[model samples]
Target chain A: MAELNRLWEKRRTDNFQMQLRYWNLIGKNSGLMFVLYAMIIIGGFYYKRWLDGLPEHFPGLLLISVVLSALSVRAPVRTFIQKADQVFLLPVEPELGGYFRSSRIYSFLVQSFVILVAWIVCMPLFFQMAGRNPVAYFLVLAAAFIVKGWNIDCRWQEQSIDDLIPLKILRGAISFLFLYSVTARLFIAVPAACLLIMLLSGAFLFHRQAARGLLKWDRVLDMENKQAMKFLRFANLFTDVPQLKHRIRARKLISSWFPVRSFDREHVYDQIFVKTFLRADDYFGIFARLTIIGMLVSYFIGNGFYTVFIVAATVYLTGLQLLALWKHPLPQALAGMYPVSFGLKRRSFVRLLFALLVIQTVALSAAGAAGMKSPAGFFAFLAAGLVAGGLFSLGYTARRIAKENR
Target chain B: MDPVLSVEHLTGGYSRQRPVLHDVTFDMNPGELVGLVGLNGAGKSTTIKHILGLLDPFEGEIRVAGRTIRQDRLGYRQKLAYVPELPELYEQMTLEEHLQLTAMAYHIDRTTFKERSGRLLKLFRMEKKRHWFPSHFSKGMRQKVMIMCAFLVRPDLYIVDEPFVGLDPIGIQSLLDLMEEMKKQGAAILMSTHILSTAEQYCDKFIILHDGQIAVQGTLEMIKQKFGDSRASLHDIYLAVARGETKWLN
Candidate 1:
């Protein structure tokens, strides 16, 4: 037991150190803090405005119930099992209760802190929607803690069972109903007895299926790897994370968006860049998200200056993120062995970046122009975006990639 | 006839101050199969890297098809194909797309690419799973993809590092048959491996590297004659040479 405790603590310490290092790097270099601060300020201002203009039927109870239940049911246990642990700890499987119990306690505290903060943020809206004091805030909070504990216990038990998606759906529905019955202080007085019955039955079914003897070590280790990978993926957007390997998804729904059909010598780099952007990982996700958010802010700002700023910022950020495409390991490994010339690779890559940046520029410029006060400002914004995007991809990005080999 | 590859006093590694390969000189003629056999850290992969132009020799010259890499960079690389020890692939690419990409990289025309890719896929028995991504592949399947891609190019020379690992018996036989076919077509092969019996059976000559140096190299008849034994197997020769090498170092 002491050996297991020591191992768990060591792993926890290592994980904390890794997180602290990346967080420090992210703070020092990425300038992400400034972006986050600006978004928060903007969000707060809009949130207050929306609250002031709130109508009678906002469905606040439904919103609170949905958000809380979703958060609770999606509880992830942070087991710090390495790949080697399966080999090293298999003989001692029956003795890992203390280790897992510690993991449960640690996860619960962290999640509770997160839930508490979310509740604090939503308090104003809760009061506003309730139309008065109604129920004590701590009473709702204590109920939240109990529900979180129940979820954490059941989720731990459920790890041993296969076909978890249907069970998860059932758990999500029960969680929502349970929170709903407990939090509706005035209008609907559903019996607390009914909610307790639902919780106990769900827990009982999950526990019985999980059968106590065998722990799915591979699944637990896989979960741990996934949690670590999520953090590493986020960190990679800021700096190069060599440990990060991008995953593949076919994205059949959006396969039509890839315009490359010819596999000629000229389209070698083009095919690689485009396929990776569309299918490999987060490059396309980040591009689409930024474009949508930029357009949304532009549409609402209605100020020519801010709209122009939004257009430039969106294009710039997308360009910066897309630069990581060149640094990917596939291109680097191919760079040496391929009979392709350095000049041809550079030209093809720059061409693709130009096309991508142009698409974003046009999309953003159109949205910005529509939000502008005058017709003349529309054309001006459009022209500016075109020139800026053109110079960026052709001149700046071209020079950067060409310098990479040197 | 001109040799397909010539390494003249090649000495280099990842760094200059402490080299991993020292004064390694060898020549590979057309329609030849040479095996590179060594223990770990014997600089087999580094030698392959230099030949592939991934690393430059610090103080010597390497010429492929009569031209140095610096003199004709693209031409020198165009005549060579490389299969790494462990496969490196684009995760999103299907097996067929990989062949297509290789064709583009090597400048094979579409008609020729389709013909060669069809034949190679049939050879490796991978035609059914042409649309499968690498994520779904086993180690043996991934190695087959690497082999198929290399053979599809039909370059003048092939550099294959440790090709026998993780391959099924059929995969191994297919690879050997492919090598034989390529040799018949006048393509030279430099294969690095530790599978001694297979190497002894297939390779026309052998280069035995020990601690970054070529300890012994020759055809089997020449090596056996040098050791004053008319019937010394490659295993006996390798063991004798390795022991002699250790004694000399001491």
Candidate 2:
């Protein structure tokens, strides 16, 4: 293995370890786990119910091919190159082939996991369209994997060439066509052979470019940073990724409601914390989306008793995510420099969180109650959710904040 | 009058087992600009953090206006402001909001805040950009925001670390001019910088920190004489100190 390959391994290992820790943090929250579990079960139940009702005229073949084509063509190539590498590693560019080769293989493997899940998802439709054959499933999957490998390799090479949008469009079309042939036809050997030929030819072209000059370090670094940011943003949905630069939008209407009145010792942290919660990094979005989702689930589940669990679980998850507001901006923020006693901060945060959670409980309860069309169930869910929300925002939160001070 | 800021035998770092700064001590008199000079990782930032009351010193006490941070946390901090090397303005805040927040944090009255912030925005030529978020601003502009926020507090003491790094020439000059004006108004400043030319030209006194200890501290003329040549530049003194680190490495 090249030295750069070892470096890549180290970078990826550290990256995965960081992600694993964040994922574990998200997992440890039992409220979130319950919500996710309920969603998956509901989703699975609906999926089978819908599948059984599929009409004979359903365009299952076209849909599966389009999905598989898109999946295979949309290959993600992550080169764990930090911006600093352009300065330090430029001298050793020629020796970087092994590093990039490892990257492609690793990305192909990682992306394959997603493709496999997608293919398995397409299984029911595929069986309906082309009759049940386990061998055919593997054969079609093998063909799609090969096409995906080619797409990843070609996409990596494409970074070297200046991307006029048309070139990207053309490459996407070419890769999609290859995967389309693999998925569209039940017989796989002909398309498999055809794909291998195209892959070889594609390699030859990129090899000629390599023979002529060094890899475009700037282009590679930019692509890597973008891909890494995409992954981090996705991961941020679960837990705070501190290194990610936050995007702040000034939502004028939403902000108008929570004005920073007087900037005094008593109101400073409260005013700012609420403003940060409402505007900074989609705290409002998470709260609103989770509340709406909880309501929708409760309404549609149509079972008043289960609506209690649904509303409780939803409010809990919403609280858990919104607590990121505290975990993120409150702790790491320069707000620490405020002259006020730190106790004031806790008091303000607790009040803000309780108020927000109370609103979520009311919103979720209204929808849930209306869905059951029973005032009794509505009050029941309202009480249940309020208790859950109150416990989370008060007792649990106060303890958590105190522990942080220690 | 007592020094506006004082540190007595401070020793601490991020980790308790492995201290980075060792017995570092300095003082800042009101209306004087003291330059803190050191190599990278030579405890300049650590020293500034201690002065800001961000980090607790294990072995010593820091005082602003004759009061330790523990004794008067709010009053102690109210007397100080800091400009970090990288502008750490809130991403969500407009330049106007940052000023307001800083003023509010220090409990500045609205009337005073408006007047001060208005003057600051004009002085930095950022009045037009008062409503712009930092994400839209270039490096120099963002740095100007940091400078404006620090000055907004109108603290008795300012702790600035490498304030010139991302600043354009004009922005740098504006900052220098502002520091000069603030000094005349009896505000003390402790600035850490690698730019020897800037320090030698602007600073009234100097502290050369080496390996977390004060290698030397005095006026530029006094430091030059200690180097055994009154005409020798501040650059020469710094290079001589940096070469000591080279000796350690080899």
Candidate 3:
């Protein structure tokens, strides 16, 4: 039992460390952060001006209350129970009450941030529309905390029951109504609705506890796994998470472009590489998305030099990311046993990267030429892209691989 | 004729400073099946890694079909097919795609690849799952995919590690039959497994490893005579060897 508590603590610590690492990486990307902060600041200035000159019949209170209530209604409790807990911890189930209670408290504290952020975002509008009363604002905050706590309890109970959709909708509706009443300062309706909600939630909790003493271990573990995977997926965007397994779909329509065919021994890896890049979501999806974004940015920029630069940068990033695919076969023993030379793997990767870059360059140059309405611009962009692709695929990538190997 | 695989005084691991396998040496003859048995952390996998050229040998050398990885890297590797302890597969590749890739890598002719893959898939009862990705497979199914891929190559040597762990009984039977068929066609195999009963039944010889060294290596009769216990089962012999109880024989 003590070990279980330690496990929970460790899970939290590890999650914190992972989040910290990624957050630091994100913070270090100064250009991206600068753009994000600029957008936020610019957006915020216009938003405040818009709020200051708002229409009188905006139903601001109703809108704010409903959104806040909806946000507050989803308070998931992270139990941190893993798949192995079913086998190892099932025998000690009765002694797990304290552990679950602690988990619930931890969940409430972690999830409180959502409620806090929602309230803060709504604060300016509330002051502008509802006439700036700190007492009323504090009351709303207290009421939101109470409602969020109730929702957490209800959701935990809901996990044990089958066919909970109707109950969930009912709870959501009631929460919206209660929040509306409180926010609107309907004194009589507020006390009455609060008491009714409390009574209803208490009864529901009692009924649920009596109906089932056993926690749904499978559901709890599944939810924990999903939550962990969500964190891992987020982390994976910045760096490779070896434990993370990306979901794969056949995407037959996309894969049809690269038909698999028998190749001689020298190009066997080339055939596999092409097939893998076309079929795998990680490689192909990234390539497509980056290429599309590059085209869009190039089209919008209109200046030939800027478009060329954007295309070059996009191609470089795409090539860098695709390097991971080169190491993919390393993890698979059977793939490693392929009689192909290490140099062949590098050649195949460079060939794929060069081909993809060429396609991107051609598309971006065409888009850039159309935007700028200059044949000379198209030729210039095309030359720049080809040079960038050649330099990156042939020189930079090969050097990177060599340095790593050495 | 030269043995298909020969590891002479091979010592290696992931790191150069600390060698996990110390002076490990063994050989597998053509048309032979040798079971490499060991407890966990006893260097069964390390030895396999050395043969597969994933790790550089810290000392000595390994040769496949009389060619060292240095002398003829591609030729050395092309002669062997490996199935690892865990089924390491591309999550994105379907069963059919895995087969296609393996066939291409081994340079199997199109008709031969089609014929071999079809027979292997049906033998493992995985024909219905030809389009299923690794994500959709159970452990047994994934193991079967590895088995199918290895069998598709029909190489001169097969290096299998703990293949029986996740396989169904029928899958195991199919694998055994395929190995036997390959052996009869003059292919050699080095299989690492803890399942003493299956190894005893199928293997022509055994290499019992302890603390990274070959503790004992021979036919059942020869091993029993060396241990001065003519009636000992392979399981008994393995347990005794793992616990260092056969010091007298050593």
lDDT score of residue A356 within candidate 1: 83
- Report the CA-based lDDT of candidate 2 relative to the real structure: 0.81
TM-score for all models, in order of appearance:
0.82, 0.73, 0.83
Better candidate by lDDT, 1 or 3: 3
- Candidate ranking under DockQ, highest first, comes to 3, 1, 2
Error of 1 at B84 (Å): 0.6
Runs of candidate 2 with Cα error greater than 4 angstroms are A1-65, A78-88, A105-150, A175-261, A278-333, A376-406, B1-3, B6-29, B38-50, B54-63, B85-96, B109-144, B207-218, B221-229, B235-250
Single out the weakest 10-residue window by summed lDDT for candidate 3 chain A. A205-214
What's the DockQ for every one of the candidates? 0.51, 0.42, 0.53
Q: Write the per-residue lDDT of candidate 2 for residues B1-250, one digit (tens) a residue.
A: 9999989999988898988899988888989999999999999998988888889999998889999988888788778888888777677777787787777788899899889889888887899997777789998888788788888888899989899988888788889999999999999999999998999999999998888888888898887777777777988788888778333212
In the predicted model 2, the residue pairs found to clash are none
**Which regions in candidate 1 have their CA more than 4 angstroms from the true location?**
A13-70, A114-147, A163-213, A225-249, A252-263, A279-282, A289-321, A331-333, A373-379, A399-406, B15-17, B245-250
How far residue A54's Cα lies from its native spot in candidate 3, in Å, is: 6.6
The CA lDDT of each predicted structure is 0.82, 0.81, 0.82
Q: Kindly list the per-residue Cα lDDT of model 2 for residues A121-228, writing each as its tens digit.
A: 889878877789778677778877877887788778776765436545655666666666655673667566566656665767654554555467787888787887
Q: How do the residues B79-184 of candidate 1 rate in per-residue lDDT, one tens digit apiece?
A: 9888888988788778888888888888888789889889888877899999899999998899888888889889999999999999988899989999999999
Interface C-alpha root-mean-square deviation, candidates in order: 2.0, 2.5, 1.8
Q: Among all windows of ten consecutive residues in candidate 1 chain A, which has the lowest summed lDDT?
A: A186-195
Instruction: Give the Å error, residue B27, model 2.
Output: 5.8
After TM-score superposition, the amount by which residue A212's alpha carbon in candidate 1 deviates from its true location, in angstroms, is 5.6
